[model samples]
Target: MSKQRDYVLRTIEERRVKFVRLWFTDVAGALKSVALSPAEVEAAFTEGIGFDGSAIEGLTRAYESDLIAIPDPSTFKLLPWRGETEPTASMFCDIHTPNGEPSVADPRNVLKRTLESAADMGFKFFTHPEIEFYLFKSKEFGPDGPIPVDRAGYFDNVPGGTAHDFRRESVNMLEELGISVEFSHHEAGPGQNEIDLRYADALTTADNIMMFRSVVKEVAIAQGVHATFMPKPLAGQPGSGMHTHLSLFEGDTNAFFDPSAKYQMSVTARRFVAGLLKHAPEITAVTNQYVNSYKRLWGGDEAPSFVSWGHNNRSALVRVPLYKPGKGNAARIEYRAMDTAVNPYLGFSVLLAAGLKGIREEYELPPEAEENIWELSQGERRVMGFDPLPQSLEHALAVMERSELVAETLGEQVFAYLLRDSRQEVEAYRRQVTQFELKTMLDTI
Candidate 1:
């Protein structure tokens, strides 16, 4: 057995861990877990537990259903929420075929492939996600619609509020699970909270995000409240978004930083942002996957209607934050359009591929959107060469269908699966009779 595997097993025993859980995500980023006794932990670490992949969403067809979850030794953690006595621990798994080849349909494998591609070109993909979510008092579904737990406005620090306590518990839970929390605070919407995770390599960060969501939900339920990462859970409030910070590194150095360049951007940084802006429209369907995600984008409040980049500009889909006076690693671009609902595995893969391609082809960064994009007139926007993002899911999918970059990044199975699934979602939305229609035109027209 590998030293790392023995270390995990030894640690579990020392901690009195009665059960060891193997965790992984399917294509849609839902957390899935299965547990084994302490007796089986060592073998599980060396080999893997077999499961039927046909049951997992977008994982396999029944004909080729065998799969295994090989635990990532580096991700082992004893669960704090499970308490100390007769303890339980968990590890994120990398799926593989029984014969031990990495499973092609695995979301984690997709990201691994992209990272390997980046490594081949002497770069590493790193990402930080600013996760946004809402804390609701109750999550009971109603015929009318969903409702928020609080009436608090943006950043309203409700002293001893349910949300306030929930944040404390959530952060505590996350820390116990070995996920670092950079900052946690009330967002611009009532019942909304944003927790920023410190940046890490793209693969680990994606795993962290999946765990982050699950941890938040678990903590909320424990506290007798409901938590949701749905982007537009409430109508008037600003929507939840998973704004991601991205940068490339070569060994220990930040590849995006240059001390003497205009805006302190390296040629590589400019092209990377240019690639993001160029492909932003086509990749929208992946980042903003759900039908409800459009409600957040179109609701304004500077939720990005166009593709452009500027230092400290919040209105653009891509923003290059002003360089810190001396911090090199902090030099990175922020992508603002992605909501919290995306499959982070696929989302990060496509983004890295697009940016790497930009570096390879020398994509030129467009003029910065210095002016408020939401306020720009059509003619003015045209003059400035700023194209608006797709206003609807249908439009977003249309663009995605024709993008060779997206297809190549996602591979054949995922590209076709996502397109097919997203279309059905769009069709379902079209068939629904919404509150707006009923209230506005039901009797008036």
Candidate 2:
């Protein structure tokens, strides 16, 4: 056995862990777990635990249902929320077929494939996400709507508020799991909050994001509140977004930085931004993957509705944050269109593929959209060559259906499933009688 696998087994015994949960995610990014006894740990490490992949959404067909969940020893961490008594530990798993081939439908493998491409190009992808979500009084809602835990606004510190305590406990739990949180604050909506995770390699960051959501929800429920990563949980309230800061590195040096270049952006960095802008619309179905996701996108606020790039322009889809002089390593681009609800593994895969395409093909970066895009007239935006993003899920899927980049990045299996899923979502939504329709036309005409 590898030293890491041996270490995991030794630690489980030392910690007196009664259960070791093997974790993986479905195509929709929902966490799935299966517990193993200490006796099964060795076999799990060596041969992997078996599961029915057909049961998982977008995982496999019934004919090829049998699959293995190979536990990654390096991801071993004791579940802090599970309590010290009757200890429990968890590790992320990689899904594979019975024949031991990597499952094309496995989201993690999708990302791993993309990262390998980056590795071949002599670059490493890193991401730091500012994840945002809302806290409600309860999961159930009445005729009115779900109630916010508090009425606090952006950065407002509500003394003895449920949200304030929720953030504190959530961050502590994340730290216990070895996930480093960079910042936490109240966001610009009632009961909404933001937690910025420190930068890490793309794969590790994706794993952390899964853990982060679980930790946040666990903390919220313990505190008698409900948490949601729904992109737009309520109308008239700013929606939650995962504005991610992305970078590429070549060994120890930052590939995005060049001190002599304009805005200190290396040619590589500009190409990366160009690539993201060029393909952002096609990838929107995955990044903002729900019918309600469009409500948030078109609802204005700080969400980037148009495809443009600029230094420190929050209104642009891709923004280059100003870094301190000589802090080349800190330089990166923030993609603002993605919501908190996306499957991070798949989301990161398409993004990395897009950026790498720019690097490989040497895409030319366009002029910066210096003025507030929201303030510009549609004609003005047109003259400036700005294009709006897909306005709805239906629109996004249409664009994605034609995207060669996204299809090649996510693999054919996942690509076909996403298209089918999106079409079903749109059809179901169209069939529903919405409250807006009821209210607006119920008594009129």
Candidate 3:
């Protein structure tokens, strides 16, 4: 605390950092911040910022609304996306109850709880998230509705297009923030892009995910474009999904690697994967939380709809990339279903919890899907023991409702809140009149 306090004070004085924002997230993963001036930062480190908790989504009730945000010195980073000039620095915050306990509503804390379980097991979870999102030309509403900026095809590099320069600038900013971008390209859908981040520990990755979203949006707006992480922004095209790559490590050793095992999958890895496959339907509502998320799940080009694992098969829900011969650190499992629209903190926690449950229970993994399950006929799929994932948000909620694992993982507060919120979203969506209905029924009448 003393050293960081000195560093922050030094940075502010030397670099002319005027504001230090304590950043945190709501249950819905929207970043919230409260700025502290240079004069009060030292005291802020000792005494947290007091605010009304009731105002935050999924936070405290109105009557008992006092909450605090304690700055995490370790996450101190200057916001490069803020501007090219005298920049503002920010730190991820820890939400605290009045009595100084970690707030249960904090998504970052939720992941920390799950990480504690992993830490107890003598392992640290590392994650690399391949986050996907869409870009659209800034538009004003006409009589109809919103529209995309361009009609570019998958990976089409339009010469001198505004989106091209926007992506370039976004990548540059991400790199400056120490968030490594392994790959960035246009997605199958027009105006969509995917950027793969190098894997790191779960907490850092979650924090980076938070930063990445803001940076992308900032860059987009600077170039007169709008960026959306909405799972399915367009119809009849592939949707944006954050197919997360996860691994377990024990003191610099990859815990999930064994040369003697089938496909070189260790028992621990198989068990973890098994737990994910088993609990997948239950966590669908969390991984795909939004009402629009279901549209992407069913659109079908790349979004996985079956609970099956494969070696290099992108179609299956989970994939184990064939290990690069000597690349031990890079060997990991990829979970296909999670999207950027989902809250990373809660999403990662639930995922790790499910996988850890498998390891603890020694759950047996099913046979690997050697062939593309999508290519197989319905009867063939049945023969191969492949079952389709939950088909809708309603169906996902039904499965989640019955899942003791998910219930336990999320605990009562979040579990109840998520289920109730999701149901309302589904119902609200169901009530809305759509273009499909109008087009089909109005002409017929």
Candidate 4:
């Protein structure tokens, strides 16, 4: 710990970093930061920086508002978007109460706690996310929604395209900050793009996700465009989803892999997938979390609506990608329901909890959907026990409210606050008349 702190201090001085940003996230996964002068960072590393926690949603109330942020030196990185002459650096912080206990309401801590539980079970959780978003002309919109910057479809390489240039710059900035991006390409949506980050431990992946979103937004603003992670930004186009690939490791071995098993999926992996299928509905509110998210889930441009898994079907909620001839470690389950708009920390926490529970309880893996679930009739799906995921934020919240796994995993304060805050959002949205409604029904009414 001392060596890491010394390294951070030395780097700050060597790089002449003008400001040090202490970063953390609110319970809802919004990034929060406090900038400190170089001289103050050393003391902050020891005593921590105090702030008003009540200002952040789901953190604290007025009566007990004080919180401290302790910088994790290992996360220290120079901000690539910030000027280089007098550079800015940032480090992720762990939120603590004044007495130095970890805050249950901290999203990062929530993930860390979940990771610890996984560690106790002799496993490590890893995630690789193919994050998708749209580059828009601007933030403003008319009767029609925001215009996409390009009309390029999936995998199209438009020469000198706006999205192309934007992705290059964003990937460059991310690499500068030491985030490993495995792949980037145009997605199915007109202006939507996807960047797949290489797999990392769950907690580090969550931190990288926060940084990834920031970098994308910063690059977009620099290029005089807007980037949105809104799950369903356009009505007719395919929606953006994170489409996370998840796996569990024991020691150095991929616990999900077995040479003799079907699809090379081991018992552990089967139970894990079963757990995810069983609890996916309950975790949807945390993973999707917005009214707009439901539009993507049920929108049906290959987005998953039913709770099923398969090796070849993209319509299934969970997908097992074809195993490579020599790559057993690459064996993983891709969870397709989660969108990029999620708070990765809370989302991963609930996901790990669900999977672990399945393993512990020896959950029975169900039959694969094998066929295109979207092409199936409602009766056929029901007959196969292919239960649909919660179709709306309202329905998702109701399902989540009854989830013991979610409640216990998120802890009391965060779980309660998320439910309360989300219900209020639902009610507020219910009262509003959307542009579609106004355009379609105003004259008819």
Candidate 5:
């Protein structure tokens, strides 16, 4: 057995753990778990546990119902929320078919496949996400709307406040699970919190994001409040975003850095940014998957609407933050369009695919948009060659359907399932008579 596997088995026995939870995600980024006693874990690591793939959202058909969940020992971590005695630990699983082939419909597999392509090109992808979400008083909301845990705004110190206490517990739990957190603060919206996870390899970062969400929710429930990662849970407040910082490395050296280049960004970095800008519209459906996600994108509180890149400009789709004098490895670009509710695995996959395409094709970097693109008129933006991203989920899906890059990166199974699931969401949304329509037009019209 590998060292990680052996260590997991030894640790479980030593800790007196009673249950081990095998975790995975569906196409929509929802967490799923299957628990087994400590005895089954060893067999699970080898023969794998059988499950109904068809029951999972977009996993497979009933005819191909047989699937296996193979535990990734490296991800094994004890559930701190479950307390120390008879503790329940968890590990993320990789789904495979009975024949032992990786399932193409698996979002995790989709990302791994894309990362392999990057590996073949001599690049290693990394990501750091500033995950944002809201804390509500309860799951049940009144007509006025959900109640936030506190009214504190950006960086407001609410000592003894629920938000403050919640963050402390959440961060501690995350650290216990081996997830490194860089920063945590109250966001601009009331009761909204932002926790930034430190950079890691793209796959590990995705797994951390999955765990982060679970930890947040678990902490909230334990404290008698509710937490949500919904992109837009309020009418006028700034929507939650996951502004992801991305970089590529080549054998321990930052490939994006060059002291002599413009903005100290290397040619490879420039092309990667070019690729992201070019493909932002097409990939929007995956990064910002929900219909509500469009509200966060177009709602415009530091959210980028147009396809442009600039140094220190939050209004552009891709922002190359000002470079620190001595921090060469920190040189990276932040893609601002994605919100917090994304399927991280698929989201990272498409983003990496787009960026890699740029490097491979040598896409010419565009001139920086010094002026805030959001402040410009449509005509001015058009003149500057800045095209806007898709204004809605439906529009994004249409763009994605035509793009060979997104289709190829997602593979046929995942691509088709995502399209079907997204189309259903759009159609369901279209049929609904929203509260706005009733409040505005019912009496007047």
Candidate 6:
């Protein structure tokens, strides 16, 4: 066996891990897993474990259903929530065909393909995601609506509070599983919370994001509450967002930073930002995938609604956070349009692809909007050359349909599937009779 595979085997034996769960995500970012005893580990590493791909969403048609999942030994981690008596571990897997060809339908492989393009350009993509979510009183909702676990808002320290204890326990569990957290705090919305993961390479960060969600839900369930990553779970409340910070590195040096340039942003950084702004509308469907996601985008609760970049404007889609003194390595751009509900693999892939296109084609960065974009009128915004993001899921999908960049980034299989899926969603939503219509139109119209 290779040394890395040997190490995993030894670690499992030493830890007395009885079950090793092989985990992978579907195209929609749903977590799926299969458990294996230690006896299957060696063979799995070499030959891979076969599964019916047709059973998975967007994976395959029923006829060509056979697929293999090869566990990535590097991602092995002991599940902290499991008991010591019968310890369980987990590892992320990459899906492939029986013939050993990479599955284009696999979201993880799509990201790997995009990262390969970055590797060719002598740049490495790194990301730090500030993920926000809400905690509800119970899993089931009533006529009155699901209740928030606590009323605490934005960094409020609620002494002897459920949320505070939940955050502490959640952070501890994450660290125990080797996911490093940078910060955790209560968000602006009641019951809403945010956790920021430390920056890692794109692939590792995606894996960490998936784990982070699992851990949060696990902890919440144990505490007799429900945690949701839904982008906009409640009306008149701030919606959850991913608010990802991204940077490119050339070997050990930060490629986005230049001390003498305006705002300390290098030429490469400017073009990267330009690319994101230019393509933000086209890629909105993937970043903010759900119908409710558009509710958050247009709700104006610190969620960006326009395609603009600024140094300190939270209302703009892209923001370059001020660089701390002697912390040039921290220079990065934050894309605020994405939500907590997106599939990180595909989202990161499209994002990186857009920025790389900017760098390759030398797209020019637009003038910064230092003022609050939310305060500007439509005419004012138009005069300033600021464009609004898609107002709804249907509009966003229409923009995505014509996007050459998104289509190329996500291979033909995924691209076609997502389009069909999104169209179905819009059609279903159109047929639904909402509560608002019943409340107002029933009596008046």
Candidate 4, which ten residues in sequence have the lowest lDDT sum?
Answer: 139-148
Relative to the true structure, candidate 2 has a C-alpha RMSD (angstroms) of 0.8
lDDT of 1 by residue, 1-445 (tens): 7788889888977887899889988877778899999898778877899999999988887999999999898888887778876798888899999899998888899999999999999999999999999887777855545556666766788898887888888888888777888989888776788899989999989988988887888888788878898978877778899999999999999999998998889999999998998998999998998889999998976688788888889988888887668898789999999999989999999899889989999999888888987888989988898888888888999999999998888788778878887888888888999888999999999
Candidate 6, 56: how far from true, in Å?
0.4
Q: For residues 43-62, could you state the per-residue lDDT of candidate 2 as single tens digits? A: 98779988889899999989
What's the lDDT of the predicted structure labeled candidate 6? 0.94
Worst 10 residues of 2 by lDDT: 142-151
Candidate 4 residues 1-445, lDDT tens each? Answer: 5999999999999999999999998877789989999999999998999999999989988898999999999899999888887799999999999988999899999999999999999999999999999999999895677988999999999989999999999999999999999989999898899999999999899999999999999999999999999999999899999999999999999999999999999999999999999999999999999999999999989999999999957889999999879999998999999999999999999999999999999999999989999999999999999999999999999999999999999999999999999999899999998878988998999
Off by over 4 Å in 1: 141-145
Q: List per-prediction Cα lDDT, in the order shown.
A: 0.87, 0.94, 0.86, 0.94, 0.94, 0.94
Question: lDDT (0-100) at residue 253 of candidate 3?
Answer: 81
Estimate candidate 4's alpha-carbon lDDT, on a 0 to 1 scale.
Answer: 0.94
Weakest ten-residue segment in model 3 by summed lDDT: 138-147
Better of 1 and 5 by lDDT: 5
Better of 3 and 4 by TM-score: 4
Q: For residue 189, what is the lDDT in candidate 6?
A: 92
Model 6 sits at a Cα RMSD from the real structure of 0.9
Give the per-residue lDDT of model 5 (tens digit) for 1-445.
9999999999999999999999999988899999999999999999999999999998999999989999999999999999976799999999999999999888999999999999999999999999999999998887879999888999999999999999999999999999999989999999999999999999999999999999999999899999999999998999999999999999899999999998899999999999998899999999999999999888878888889999988888899998779999999999998899999999999999999999999999999999988789999999999998999999999999999998999888788988999999999999999899999999999
